[model samples]
Each structure stands twice: as structure tokens, then as C-alpha cells.
Target: MSQNNDNSVLFGNGDELPSNASDNPHINQLIDGVGRRQVLAAGAALGTLAFLGSVMPGAAVAAEPAAKGLEKLHFRPRSKLPFTAIATNRLDSISVPTGYRATPFIPWGTPITGNYPAYLSDGSNSAQDQAEQLGMHHDGMHFFPIDAQRGGKKSDHGLLVLNHEYIDAPLLHPNGPTLVAGKRSSAEEVRKEINAHGVSVVEVRRGLNGEWAVLPSARNRRITGATPMQISGPARGHALLKTRYSPKGTATRGTLNNCSHGFTPWGTYLTCEENWAGYFASRDTDLPRELSRYGLRSSSRYGWDHLKGDEFERFDATRTTTTASADYRNEPNHFGWIVEIDPFAPESVPVKRTALGRFAHEGLVFAPVKSGRPVVCYSGDDSQNEYIYKYVSRDKYRPGRSNGRLLDEGTLYVARFDASGKGEWLALDIYDKKFQQACKAAGVSFADQGEVLINTRLAADVVGATKMDRPEWGAVNPDNGEVYFTLTNNSARTSVDAANPRPANAFGHIIRWRELCKDYAGRQFAWSLFMLAGPEADSIGPNGKPLTADNRLASPDGLWFDEEGRLWIQTDMSGSQLSSGPFGNNQMLVAEPRTGELKRFLVGPVGAEVTGITATPDFRTLFVNIQHPGEGSTATNLLSTWPDGPGQRPRSATVIITREDGRRLL
Candidate 1:
């Protein structure tokens, strides 16, 4: 769903309180003194010779001497970015540089599993058909090479796994959602919509003629809102997770609102649940802190609860028989987690790793894994003024021997960015005495570690984690182990801090940090703002100048780093901001981290947010997803007919972009 939509449902109404506690002192002094020090230090070398080639128009920045930590890492020679930056436009189509070719593939209704049903053009496909076809609104994805030994050169065949975030009900049905007396009436329509929200695993191969096609294989599968899954890790078998479907609290029925994703070294997919609270609602006067803290409302987004039967009634999430196991009140606790799926094992059930804590997980990114160190990862809660988190496994990673069990036993920590340009990872573990005292003083109570993780937001709040500006997607630099997270716009922010300096920030920014001594599991780190996203007027680039036409962007969302450490950033501007601002339709840009240069790589159609990026190992085939084109428009006042132009309805699809010369994309 667009961030600018009526999000009161996703985040509760005005009566709902903010996640961060009012007494937390961490917010009052984020970057106040530190930013001035860094700016003055950089100005000292402003007259030095330019070390990196100038890529921006009439722009050049002098190089500064290497500092401690990541700056001391060996720098490798990198080839200059090859293509010219494209101009921003509001056209309803994909745009790329002059030497690139883009082809749409695996759009919304393309069948890949089961009986291989064909997509019905008039939106007449049944709910069963949708279960067999590609789900809607593709987001975070990864391409796993079939030829494992080939390493970074295998690009011919692989498994493509992508997320189906949410559905636009009006576009999924023949005319619109069926309504009987102002409530959803068609069970098939609701079922079809539910079937469309999950992940799609398809086997794709590059043909001999330089084209790509979905190949029928046993690896292709669909995990929808109805797919059964096991709840693993700390919160497993907890009373808060007990439901009629899983009386033991060891399992759940489905995964929903999967936005961004991650992949484990042991070869598993981690699909994150974001904005899932809006799907379930309650008619009760009071709701559990687990649901209420995560923004549960009295009304639902799609009204899935309006239907009868256990399958549909679970969405209500209200107390019926007083016992948690007898009703679906614990249903909300089953979501807001990182679910692990074995893509190669088609029949294996997905597991929700609760040790990673619960919140509106935008995505998860792992640090460069080492043979003997703990498996470490970072995640961001994608909401206004939420907190960023890191999870460090208690078990050591033993190369091929490592598995999702490493995630099952871990210590989750919330970030606390201080005013001295450094940060600390505050443990949310129940055993931590500091955290225990903080909870006691705040009048919050937790019975065990599982409760601490299940109520992670409240735990972070009492311990004074720094509230950020809508942290979204995160990426780690492969060369130096520096972590970068995009803080998407937060217009609700009324106070300025070091990490989030702009009050009522409309254009979000990127913040990066290098772990102390390059230890991925270490608690201390140094951080700084990488880029402030906006028009040339108010934004700040890494070079300390305003954004130029070549790379103007806002609402930075999806982020990833290629094999060479080149950062690729995607934008997600919504509502009137997407079309009317200096920014055009959402775009994907490639950034040279060393030179602080950004070039627009691709742009999507009107009303679509360009997200979910992954590249072939050979760096030749780049797959990007364009989600929800013509989002708010209906059949009569159509706004876009993209990928299948002119007369057809707009369908979200993955565009495969390759260099015209059939060479490396960079």
C-alpha cells in the first residue's frame, strides 16, 4: 500500500499513542553537536584535489583523508558508471538509459504452479486460479542461482522469490469488491484477495535467444495468506500466540503484507510482515498491547472479517469465548515477524523466527557473514518515528552447518544513536538488568524473553531507543561492513534530533554506520547521514550539495548493494507528492559510494512505486518490480495501462533490464 494512503488504519486512529515513550531522552540530542563537527572537519579539506571523477553536472567535491574503521579498509578500483542519467518524466511507462533494454515478465496473474492456469484478462479468474498464479503487488525479491558452484557468474537459470505486499481490492475483481448491505459479500473475492497476498517462487531462465522465460519446475510454489506455517524461535509456544488454529501456539495459518525480504547463508528466504495490523481488527472496547501497540483498529483494511466461517472470521481478532485458545484474539500476535522459507524444498513449511522481535518489519539485511562469528542482521520498523533493530545470534555460524536455528536463538537489540556521532545497541533481552529496571520504572511488565520479543516496540520504548524518521529498507556495504538504512519521510515528526533533523520531514534521508572494530556483533558503532533525499532546493547529497536533476529523489525505500558494493536506491513517493513534486514517477538509481555520485537508472509508470530489486550474479540481468500502477483510479477514470499499454488494465509486473550490448550492467 502507498504510504500516503489513509494510513490511520495501518497506524491506529488519533487515540492510539506513538511507539516511543515521551520521557526517552535519546531523541532530544541525536546529531546536534556531532553534525557540526563533521561538517567543519570536511570543510578543512574542501580545497584538496578531487579524488573521484565528477559525474554530476557542474559538481565536484574534494576528497578527505581516510579516517578510522571502514575508511581504513582497502579501496578497490571500480569502473565508472557507464550510462548517462535519464531525465525524470511522468509518462506511464518504464524508462531507462539509452543502452538498456527492459522487458516485462511475471505480471500479476501469470500462472507458475499447480495446474498452470492462464490469467483471465477480464479479472474473471477464480480464487483457485489466483493460488496457482503470481500474487499481486510484488516487492522485495532475490534470485538464487541454480548452479551453486558457479558463484557470481551463474546468471542463466535461478529461482526468483518476490513478495506480494497487499491488494487493491477494486482492481482485483471484475468491477469492484462485491458488497451486500455495505459489507464484503463475495467469499470468492475475499479469498482471491487473500490468495494474492504472500510470496511467489518461480524458476526463471535466460533463453538462448537472449530472452527470459518462466520454466516449469518443482521449485515454483506460492505461499499465501492461507498457507500453514510453524512458529519457531523465542516466541514459539507462548500463550500470546495461542489460537484455535494452533492450540499449542506452535503454528499459524498464513503470512501477510510481506513487503521486503532477506536470505540466509544456509539458503532460506526471510519474508517480512509490514502493515499487517490493518488486515485484522477488533470490535472489543479494549485490545491487547500486542495488537494495540502495533496499530490494531476497530475497522479493517479489506474487511476480511466481514465474512463468516473460521477461515475469514480470524481477521476479526476479538475475544469470543474468554480463552485465547478458543478464539482468534491471539491472531494478531502470529504476524509481525520474519518468516523463513526453504525455496528449494517446495513442501517444507515456512517458519516464523520470533527471536528477531516483532514490529512493522520493512525488511531484513544481514551483515557479511564470517565462519566463526555470530550471525548478525539489521531490520527497520517502517512507521513514523519508529526504531531500528539488530539481531545477533547466540550460536556461531559454521559455514555450511549454519541454518535458521541460528536465528532461533539470538539477542535482539534496538539502536540508540547518541549525539557524539556514535551509537550503541541496547539489548532488549529479558535477562538484561538495565532493561529489566527500565521496564519496572515504566510500569511495563514482561514474564519472560518471549514476552519481551513479542512486545519489542514497548521494550525498546522503555529502554530509550532513538526514535527515527520512518526507517524502511536497509543494506550493508560488502567491502567495509558499514550498514545503511533509509529513513523514509515522516511528516508527523514535530521535533528535530541528530539522527532525524528535519521537523515534519517530507523528503527522507539515508543513514549509515560502521560497527566498532568491524565487529558485526559488537554493540558500539559510529554513524552519519549519507544523503538527504529531496529536490535541489532543500536536500543534501553526500557531497554536501543539493540534489541535481540527474538524481533527485524522495521517500527512499528499497535499497541493495551489488557484488561490487555499488548501492542501488529505489524511491516510493505517494499520493499527490509522487506526481506533482519535482520528483517524477518513482525511480531506481545507482550510486557510486566512493564518489558520492548518483545516477537515475530506471523510472516506473504513473502511480507506481519502483521497488523490489535483485540482479543476476553476472550483473547483466536486473529485475525490478513496479507496484500498483494507477493505484487510486477506477475502471472509468483509468490512469495507467502500463506493461500492457493502451486498452488493458494496469498490472504490476517485474521488468527485466539488461544492457543492450549483452555485457555487465554497470
Candidate 2:
């Protein structure tokens, strides 16, 4: 059943009290505050009521100027500030602000070294060529400073680790691959596709007067689908991960569908894997007994199985044979986790830390870690009706400069929201008797923690975690320590319980939570509906106060906070939706969370999904990506003529946004 078709039940009235009030006196105090305010007010006031205005907490009070065009953020800004839209159809390019300039920092198939030539884009790029060159479909990225000791200053150079989600076959191959009965071209072609499916690490530096470019330094590296990466935590070496590449089952070769990303406190890069299941193609007739165990009931979408003689056949997870020991039953277990890369240490191997649990991981955000307390990381599964998760390190963090060893050991928990406005983090541990009983009762087989992490969806389902709309990127409010996450609309999610109840969620909403005692690792927390995304008229709170337009956004995907604690939100919508005129196109927004002061900061051309937002420490310069502009168009039919080229197909490119007057983005 599609997620939208599910039943909708009001979770509870928004004014309900805490579910466990007896044990928590804070609830009583909050309840009293609500009662006292009601007695004083007597009735709901409509126009510009200060009491309704204060409901959003830290929202800014000052009205923001409408976006006539790009303007400065009014704070200390970066000089040489300029903004430009990169032009492209086939080959992607970078766009910069007016005075500022941008060049090709890196491009697909640009060789790192060895005998590989630059990419021909005609399917001639080899596995070795792919290993040395940048991967296809560059998405979420971060610029890690070479020297953090410099403190909040832009580095002349740094390491850039970018994700290559998936390859567009028509663009990669000259005449398209030779498909035979819904299979791929050749073994060589299949190999090239595999090698192009991971993270690309390149050293980049700003030249004299702040021109950013890639440097062919020794630290440049590429981790592909065949690159050896260790699997850590409970799910390592389980029966599911054993592939022909690693029969011992201790490691997997690479990561795929890397969408959004995060940065660890110790300076490592975190790449998330999303929508990976579509790449493989298996036959329905070959269904194995273990097929349902790994969510592969349908044929593979990519047609990789048609390759005459290639290991791509392993994409078929359905067991044609009765026994799990035959063929490649364990191949599906390698993906859907947060992979960490140490950009500072080029020689370091990427590790899949399984303690974070597994699903369609979108991004990971670290909560502020106190010296004597456990560190916490928040993550979201990007599929409709999926769950939000947190991983708290079992060991406490030490203040002095330490590598990210704390991340290697942690307990993963999924959220369960109660009707009374409080929530609990349900632990997912194979060692726990409760977990074992739950797993058995659900008729799923799990032998250890490794198995639990491998099948986290099953475990979460058994535990009754709150299923949400498509949960996308998240950002923590630096000023107030509240966790804010975007629930992108779920076309399939129509069921409304307490948390998610709307059908055809045209635009979605942002949900926020504050931990008790301000502890990031706390298992229990308090939460509230931050803001609903739609027209301003639709955002009425329970108290009959109108929510500000800044708090009303649709399909929020990428979210980040600048150095000065300003929140940036980016949107993504399909082509048909854009053409209808209800919305212009995907755009970027800036908001002061405390006051619900939000405004459209920038808008992209047609057919683009605005994504991948990050800012320099000074908040003067911002980088955003325009993905798949004119995305639904084919060679035979075209819609948008963006980045302006001669009969060129639109290509996704990164844009640098800066103020014309040289002011910060706050």
C-alpha cells in the first residue's frame, strides 16, 4: 500500500498535556502556564496578537524585505562577493555572484592519475578511468578546512568530498548501452558503472584574490563501489553482508546513491546513501525464499541483469534457489548507512559505522556534546512513512582534541511520539530480551546486533515507531538547541495519527524538539509542531493565531545553519507541479527561527531541484546546487533553456551565492 493511502487519525488535540505527567513535574508547570495565560486572555485575539506571535519562540521580530532581487544579509559580509548561475546542458559548470568568479573545480571523468584519459562520455570511461576521475551526479558536499587551528577563517585550500548518487546512462554512453532482454550492455560497461558509484575526494584551493579551483595534490582520492571499506559495530560480518568480494563478511566495497552529508566534530565527512534500491534489476520469476527478507519482491529497475556476462546479475535479491547459501543472496546488505571519510587523512579507509542503524539515510546532524556526556547524532530515512533515528555513543566524549573514535560505538534508537507531546527513543539492540521477543513475534529472523542493524526497518516496525512523511535534511538551532527537521511531502502517506495526519500534503512541515535537561543523549524529549508548510492562511495554530509566511514552506529538502545561527532552507518540487503556477520554482529561503522571520532569499531557473546548501564560516559566501534542471525533458523534447547553451541538455551544477554589497548572509 502507498503511504498516502493510509488512514488519517488525529494524534490528539494539539493542546493535550504530557502523557506521563505524574513522574514529570515540568509538565505540571507548563500546564499551569497555559491555564494562567488562558484565564488572563479569556478569548482568542485575531489580528497580530502578541500572545499568538510568541508561540513560535525564537522567531525574529523585524520584518524582512521582499526579495526584489539578491540582497546582502546586513552583517559583516565576504568581500569579492558575487553570485552567478552556471550555464550547462551536457557539461556542468559553476555559477558565481556578480564580482566573484567560479571555474570547474572538478568534472565527471577528469582523471586523478594513472593511464586514464579524461572522460569521453561515450561509455569508453573504464573502471580504472572512473576510479581516478570525479563520479557522476555530484550532490551534497562540504569544504573541510586543512587547518582548524586557524579558527573560523576561510582556508586558501581544503579537501572537497562530494557524492555521486547515480549515473544517467544516456549521457554516460554514446548510443546508449546494448540492452538484450532488459539487461545491460557488456561486462566492461557494468564495471564502469560500479566504479562510478561512491564518494570523490579532491584537494581544492582558492587562488590569489579568492578564485576557487581544484589542485592536483597527492591527497586527492576516490572511493568507489569496489574500494575496500571496513564495516564496524553490531551489523558487521553478519550472514547478509557476505559477498563474492568479501567472503568473510567483514567489509563492503563502496557506497551508492549518496544524497546529503554531514561533518563530524573531529573533522571527518559523513556521506548518506539514499534511493539505492532502484539501481538493480532482478527477475520476478527467479524469486527466492529469502527475497522478501531484503525488500526485493519486484524486478530490478536498472536492468543490470541483461549484461551478457557480468556480476551485475547479483542485483537480483530474489532467491531462485531454495537455500540462502546459493548464488549471491547477501549482496543487498551492503548499502543504506552513514559512511565516514577522513578528508585530512587521505590514506584512511572509509568506514560504514553500523551503530547508526540502517535505512535510506539522508543526512546526519551532531548535537552539541558536553565533555562528560554521551554524543548524539540525528538521522532521517528519506522514504515515505519511514522513521527518524538517533545514535548516542555508549562512551562519553573527552574534551581535548580526539579523533572521532566515539562514533564507532553507540546505541541506535528510533523515535516514538506520544499523543501528549512527549517522545521516547526506543532502543534497537539484539542483546535486549524485549527486542528478541519483538523480533520473534513479528516472524523475522535476527540472531545478533549485526542482524538487527542489518534489518533495522523490521525492528522499527515491530517497535511501533512513529511513521512520518518523507523525512529529509535536518538542522539544529544553534541559539536554542532545538532540533528542526523537514518532513518532505509524502504522496503515499495519507494516514494521520497524532504526528502525521494530512492527506495530499501539498507542502510539508518542520518539526522541532528540545531534550530534557538540554542533554543531546537523553532518551526522552519534549516536542512541538514547529511550522506547517503551505499558504499563510493554512498555518493557523491551535490557539487561532496565524503562522508567519516564513514558517510556511513546501517540500523543504536541504536545511543548514550558518555560523551566525541563521537557518537556510531549500526547496524541491516536480516539473508538473512547477508548471501549474501555484509555485514559481524551487528556491532558497533564510529565516530567523526564534521569531519565525523567513523570506525567499533566492530562486532557481525552471526544472531544478534546489539542494545541497552550505556556507563559509563567515556566512558571507554560500554554495547551493541546482540538480536536474529540465529534469523530465528528453532529447526529443525540451522545456527549460537554463545555463544557456547550444542545443545542450540541462546539467546539474553548483552555484555560489554571495551578497552584492559584501554583507554576511545572516
Winning candidate number (TM-score): 1
Q: Looking at model 1, which ten-residue stretch has the lowest summed lDDT?
A: 49-58
lDDT of 1 by residue, 1-666 (tens): 366446444221111234454456534245443332233234222311111122111112212223444334455777767789999999999999998998999999999999999988678899999999999889999999886424535789999999999887777788978887768888999999999989999999998888999998999999999999999998999999999999999999889999999998887899999888888889889877887788787888788899999999899888989799999999989999999999889999999999999998999999878788899999998887689999999999997678899999989999998756667999999898989888889999999999998999989888888988878899987656668999888877666666676667888888887677544788888666677888888777765566899999998999999978788999988866776978999999988776677889998999998999998988889999999888775655568998788877788899999989999988
Off by over 4 Å in 2: 1-128, 149-152, 281-294, 308-311, 318-326, 399-405, 433-445, 536-553, 633-644, 661-663
Candidate models: Cα lDDT each: 0.82, 0.61
List ranges where model 1 is wrong by over 4 Å. Answer: 5-22, 25-74, 149-153
* Cα shift from native, residue 61, model 2 (Å): 17
Distance from true position, residue 209, model 1, in Å? 1.5
Q: Report the C-alpha displacement of residue 119, candidate 2, in angstroms.
A: 5.3
Give TM per candidate: 0.94, 0.80
